[model samples]
Every structure is written in C-alpha cells, then in structure tokens.
Target: MNPVIHFEMPYEDRERMAAFYRSAFGWQTQMLGPEMGNYVLATTTETETGDRGPTQPGAINGGFYGKHPDWPAQHPSVVIGVDDIRAAMEKVSASGGQVLGEPMEIPGVGHYVSFMDPEGNRVSMLQPLPRG
Candidate 1:
C-alpha cells in the first residue's frame, strides 16, 4: 500500500504558525523564502539526515504553506508517496477523484500534485527523488 509520507496545512501567518508549533510541540520550523513560495517546513521528529524525514517509521514530517485566496480547499492534508506520478494520477482519476492539475517538480524534493478525493478532501501525492 502507498504510505503517507508528509502532511500540509495552510497558515495565514507563517511566523505565528511556526512559533506555535515550535513552542507547543517542539517542532523545528524552517521558513523558506518567496522563491520557494514562503513554505514553512516542520520537522516533528528526529530525521535520518537532517531534513530527509523522520527516522522513526510511520512518523512523518510536514509543512505549512501561506494561504491564498485563489487556492481551493486549503485544509490539513496528508501526502501519499507513489512510485510513478503519472500512474497515480490516472488511478486517482479512475477512482472518481479529481487531479487538480499537472504535477510540478519541487526542487530537491520531487514531483508533487494535489487532488480532491470523492469526499471533497484535498490531498497530495509525491514521487520522491531516490535517496542517495
């Protein structure tokens, strides 16, 4: 089965959100600049290689993105890791889910895309670059 590898949530104030998570949960937050869309990466647990991901199995990392008025369904969502993005997109479409748009490559991360499930929940999928 495909596994959830990450999560995402929209935030109106990136600094406030990061501070809250850091203070309450001891999560490490790294704020990316505008070139990267001002995303905030949250490391919830010890990672294998600094920013690679959680070392503990089943424990995932996540990020917070600035909420945009034009974005649809900006809610908390999990990202599923898939081997082949195109195949996954087709599968999602065949299963009655709507793939929002073409997949986009995240520099040093991987190919990512969002979709709306049948239940109207927005989720994402990622095809990660092979770990070195």
Candidate 2:
C-alpha cells in the first residue's frame, strides 16, 4: 500500500496554486501527462534522513490540481486508496450509489474513479501500483 493519500482542491489558477504548495510545504511535483491526465503528483520526504521514512516517501501520491471555472467552489474532496475501482463501483451501484467518473489511469501510477455513496458524501478512489 502507498500509506497516505491526497485530495484535489479546485483552484482558479492551477499553476500558481501548485507553485504556492511547492514553496510553502516543500512538496516536489511532477507533471503526469496523457495516461495520468493533466495532473501533477506531490512528493513528500523525510527531512532528517532524506528517505521515504515513516513520514514521507521518495515520491508518494501527489494531489491533483485543476480548475472549476464553472461549478461553485465546494468542500474539498479527498481521494481514498481503493483495491479495485470497477468492483467497488459495482458494489456502489448495487446498493444505492452512483458512479460519477469512470475508471481512469493516473499516468504511470495507477487508476482512479469518483462516485457518490448511498449517504451522498463526495468521495474518490485510486488504485495504486500493484504489489510485487
């Protein structure tokens, strides 16, 4: 497992927002094109040892940055680490949930999908690299 996960915050200026985070938190980011869509991964690290310690890894999952030029800004949404998005979606639909976004790859990372549960709290899921 990737341990910690991240959330997506809708920004008016994605580039500027990303820069702000990088500067403020010392977060390393990398642009993931095509396969991962137009999103960047935020990397956390351990300052003392400079290793993927209990706190951070060489390149953990970075939050995705984007703009909501249309919808009104709402509560921040966190993406949870899921085992299987498709199977989970099936379970969601079987109950009373609805799938919002279909399964999509996160560049060379993994896959993710968003959906609403029976209670209606906004949530997302990401399937990280399979265990070797």
List lDDT for all candidates, in order: 0.95, 0.64
Question: Which candidate's lDDT is highest?
Answer: 1
Q: On residues 1-132, what C-alpha lDDT tens digit does candidate 2 reach at each position?
A: 433366665555567867888999888766666554466666655433432222644334445656545533334677777787788788778988787867877554579777777776666778777644
C-alpha lDDT of residue 110 in model 2:
76
Top candidate on TM-score is: 1
Please report the TM-score between candidate 1 and the true structure: 0.97
lDDT minimum window of 10 residues, candidate 1: 48-57
Q: Which stretches of model 2 miss by more than 4 angstroms?
A: 1-4, 47-61, 68-75, 118-120
Clashes of each: 0, 3
